[model samples]
Target: MKLAIVAVGHRQPDWISAGCSEYLKRLPPEMAARMIEIKPEPRGSKSREQLLAAERSRIDAALPASVRLIVLDEKGDDLTTLKLAGRLEQWQADGRDAALLIGGADGLDPALKARAAEKIRLSSLTLPHGLARLLLCEQLYRAVSVLKNHPYHREG
Candidate 1:
């Protein structure tokens, strides 16, 4: 199974890159994952809606073909690590590639959110794009570890 993390942001702090890289490097080869960063729309002279729409268009264009769309949004469903593992198992079993969409600061477009095959939130609280990217990478690695029964994952 392949996973694509398509996030709308560039120029994240060095710590975020290091953290994300660490988790990405830990992922096993079978569960291939790649990150695609989309340039964020400049907020200058643009309405909130316009920014969202611009980002939405770029995200739509960046999406890898034939992958399930899993978008990140504040109001989306909450998922536990185990639940995510179950989803990972299902995706792997079905040989499906999933595109995880992380929107810009203004959040996702309403229509784009509606189109997501799965809408999930990393946290109830707001997070910066860099931290979100790092956290998602770590969680995905944790889910893979659970699937493999690797000692890296410890259940509470």
Candidate 2:
């Protein structure tokens, strides 16, 4: 199944790109994983509402018509690594692409969140947007590895 991580903003730190790239390259050819960076609106003195609307529009545009939307938010469900792997397996079996969405600094827009079929949270603590992208990529790789019986994931 194809998995796409749709994140807001660009020009991230080198480490973020490197880390994400590492996992993307290692992902099995049959289970495609890619990161689509959604550029945030130009920030200045714009109102909070305006900024959110603009960012939401960009995210909406990046999503593919056939993919299932999954929003990443702090308030979303927290699942174990194994459970995440199982979930992806189910998605693959259902023949649907999983599109994971990461919001901008101000968090996800209400409209976008409402449209998501599933929601996930990385952790309770807040993380930098760039770092969050890298973290998500690593976790996705780990989940896939576990599902495929790779030695990369270890459960205590």
Candidate 3:
């Protein structure tokens, strides 16, 4: 099953795109993944709920069919690289596509988070959007490396 990262904020800097691309290309076909960027709703005067509602609409539209939904939240459970590797292995074994949703600056709708199969926190420290994207890609690659017993995962 392929993995899909549905994130808000479309126009990431070149380095962010390049960094994500490098790791994503390294993933094997069975763990193939893609990112879907949604345009951030204008923040001017809109309520948090309104902003989330607008963005969620786009996210739902972009999601692939029959995928297990996973959300990235600051308050979500922290997953170590090894744990992520185990989770990835299980997902692959299940043969179900996985969709990881990364919300806008305000984060995803509460109802969405509640319904997700899992909520993961990339870090305990707050990270800039670009850095967070890069880190996520890097970690996903590291997780895959661990699963395949590649030296890359241990080299660091």
Candidate 4:
């Protein structure tokens, strides 16, 4: 099964790349994640709707057809780590590609959210796009570890 993170915005700081890479490198071969960055629409004097529309197009284009789409939005389900692990385990078992969509600064388009098979939130607080990407990578690795009986996650 293939897992992909299709996110908007780029030119992130080096630290973000390093942090994401650390977890990405830890993922076992079958569950390895791919990061596909969609260039953000130039913010110069464009209305929010216009910006979002542009981003939506790019995001849609980046998505692989017939795959499970999961959008990351603040309004999405705030699943616990264990719950996320269970979901990931099921997706992996089904042998289907899964795509996680991270929206741009203005957030996801309404249509995009509607199209998502599942919408999940990484946190309640607002996070920079780069930081969100890093967090998602780490959590995916943790989920995989959990599924594999690795000692990476500890429950209280």
> Per-residue lDDT for 26-144 in model 1, tens only?
88888878888989999999999999999988988988777888898887789999999998888788777888899877788888888888888999988988999999999999999
Off by over 4 Å in 3: none
What lDDT is reached at residue 28 by model 1?
Answer: 86
- lDDT by residue (1-156, candidate 3, tens digit) is 899988898689998999999999999998998988999999999999999999988888898888899898898889999999999988889888999888889889887787799989999999988788889889999999999999887744
Each model's RMSD to truth, in Å?
1.3, 1.2, 1.3, 1.2
Clashing pairs in 2: none
Taking the tens digit of each residue's C-alpha lDDT, what string does model 4 give over 1-156? 788999888678999988988988899999878889999999999999899999999988888878899999888899988999999988887778999999888888888888888989999998888999999999999988888899999989
lDDT of 2 by residue, 2-97 (tens): 899999886798988999999888999878889998888777999877888999988878787878889999989998889889888888897888
Name the 10 consecutive residues with the lowest summed lDDT in model 1.
87-96
RMSD of 3: 1.3
Best by TM-score: 3
Q: Enumerate clash totals for all models, in the order shown.
A: 0, 0, 0, 0
Flag regions of model 2 displaced more than 4 Å. none
Better of 2 and 3 by TM-score: 3
All candidates' lDDT scores?
Answer: 0.88, 0.87, 0.89, 0.89
The candidate with the higher TM-score, 1 or 4, is: 4
Model 4 score (lDDT): 0.89
